[model samples]
Target: MIRTGILNPAVLSLLARVRHTNTVVVADRGFPLWPQIETVDLSLVDDVPTVRQVLDAILPQYVIGRIFAEEEFRQVNSPSVVEALRDHTGAIPLVFEPHVEFKRRVPHAIGLIRTGDSTPYANLILESA
Candidate 1:
């Protein structure tokens, strides 16, 4: 039995298979479910386990090379949510693209983690290092 690090079996299994340069998305509640991509739905309730909460849990287990977000994230999401993401990311560079373009890239990610955050455009794409 696993004693520590991402307790969710599905999440752990997905992360275990992630390779360098692979993409994983940690997205908000409203993010579309792509039929072609594997999705790990973690949303229990509105804002129950937020994007930041999941990111904090996953950050230690993965070596992330870069992060991608919707260009409107700053203007649409709460300041606290944005700040929390920035704090967790630290030195990792954040690359922003239009929401349409961001969604276009989701199908290519190895996995998409759906969080309970209600904030608008609170999605993030992490590239494994």
Candidate 2:
């Protein structure tokens, strides 16, 4: 009967469980899987649904306090890609660290959503407000 907003049941369930300061990861298609953390694989094809595309769907429903990403994202991806992501993030503070440190934070996230984005280092961890 529900016909609007986030329609994916798995994604809705995952968002429902998030609390203040809890983290949720939106990773690219190539991001490594963590057996210990729950994941919703939304990947349809290579670059079919980008990480930004998923974020667009979740941003209105989720309260993101901060975003964490790899410093290398800006270095590896085009300037337009970086700017596009920044525009989507709006006022949310974005912090960048080394790739290793970024991965270390993944296990603590409430859940991860894997996207079909092929962009290198396109992964991001959003901490709930």
Candidate 3:
């Protein structure tokens, strides 16, 4: 049996394989869970398990250096989300990028966590450290 949070099988597998500097994605439901990238589908419904919840759970144990999100989220003034992240991990610097460019980055990520969140442009790229 697992001893802590984040017992999701797929998530555990990805986290196990990820090494320092490897990039991972904790994405909202709207983002596609591409087969090319290792995917952890935790979505139950429209908002079953949010991106924030999943990220918060894993950040405590994972050492991630950089976290990148769609540039749109920065423009939306979603400081609460960013603030919460600071509690668990170091600065998750926000980056603004074209939507197309953002989507293009996911497939190359070492892991992709699909959440049930509905927030716009809520995909994030987390680099392991």
Candidate 4:
């Protein structure tokens, strides 16, 4: 029985399998689903559980080495959204690549977490340290 930390068994299982340098994706609701990767869909409704909320939950439990995001995230999202994302990503090096390049990396990820966040290009790929 677990008393604290991540309580979701599916999420726990996914994180447990992550090795150093491995990546896991915390994606927005609109992100495309990849058939090759394992996904734990937590989306309930529009913005029910946001990308930030999922990041907040997993950050404490996971040792993240880097964060990969789409370059269009900054261009498409509002200033507040960008700032909020920055707050969640504190200290972890963030790399922005083209959206096409970002999707190209998804198939190799350990797993995908689907959140209800509607923020444009809010998806992130977190690499284990």
Candidate 5:
């Protein structure tokens, strides 16, 4: 049996299909998942598995081109979460897009990892590198 790397079957499936410059959305629990897009739901309970946590595990395995998150999340009064993201992704810059725009963009994502994070609009669309 497989005993190394990603143990999550869904995550492993998405990771296998991800390629350079491909788009993947690591979104909040409430983020809408389009029928046409592939979704990897890792959420078990509220804040059980954070969006950043998921990225940390997946990003190292996959080469990501860039990341897109809501502009509003940057101005968050609680800087801890954003700071965690900054620390997690490092130099990979985050592009700010409106909420509607974020939703519109997810449908085109090659894969979407839905997290249980309750943070406001804690959604990130990443471009495979």
Candidate 6:
């Protein structure tokens, strides 16, 4: 049995399958579900396991190359969310795209892990390193 890191079997298995350059989305609860892409829904309740919580668990397990966020994230989300994102990402450069364009790219992601964060525009696309 796994003792550390992400204990969720589905999430662990999905992380193992992701390859370099592959895109995985850590999305907020309200993000649209794409039928063509695999979704690992981890949302329990409002702000249960937040986007920061999931990222903290996953970042150590995966080598992320690039992080993408909606252009409106700064405007829509709380300052704490932004600070948490910065704290976790550190040196990783953040790229911002329009929400429409961000949604347009969702179908191309290998998977989306939904979190219970109620913050608007909290979704992020992580490109595997």
TM-score of each: 0.93, 0.98, 0.84, 0.96, 0.90, 0.94
lDDT of 6 at 8: 92
Better of 2 and 3 by TM-score: 2
Q: What is the C-alpha RMSD of each candidate to the true structure, in Å?
A: 1.2, 0.7, 2.3, 0.8, 1.5, 1.2
**Candidates 2 and 3, the one with greater lDDT:** 2
Error of 4 at 28 (Å): 0.7
Question: Candidate 5: global Cα-lDDT?
Answer: 0.82
lDDT of each: 0.89, 0.95, 0.77, 0.94, 0.82, 0.88
Model 6, span 36-128: residue lDDT tens: 988999999998798888989998889999999998998777888778778888888888899998888788888999999898888999999
Better of 2 and 6 by TM-score: 2
lDDT of candidate 5 over 1-129, digit per residue (tens)? 677667898888887887767788898888775789888788999987988788877776888778888977877637887787778878887788887787888777788888998888888988977
Candidate 1 has a TM-score of: 0.93
Q: Which of 4 and 6 is the better model by TM-score?
A: 4
- Residue 104 local lDDT, model 6: 81
Candidate 2: worst 10 consecutive residues by lDDT?
A: 1-10
Candidate ranking (TM-score, best to worst): 2, 4, 6, 1, 5, 3
Q: Please, what are the lDDT tens digits per residue for candidate 3 over residues 78-100?
A: 78865555554556555557777
Question: Which candidate wins on TM-score?
Answer: 2
In model 3, which runs have C-alpha deviations exceeding 4 angstroms?
77-92
Tell me how candidate 3 scores on lDDT: 0.77
Candidate No. with top lDDT: 2
> Once model 1 is optimally superposed onto the true structure by TM-score, how far is the C-alpha of residue 30 displaced, in angstroms?
0.8
Whole-structure CA lDDT of model 2: 0.95
User: Clash totals for all models, in order?
Assistant: 0, 0, 1, 0, 4, 0
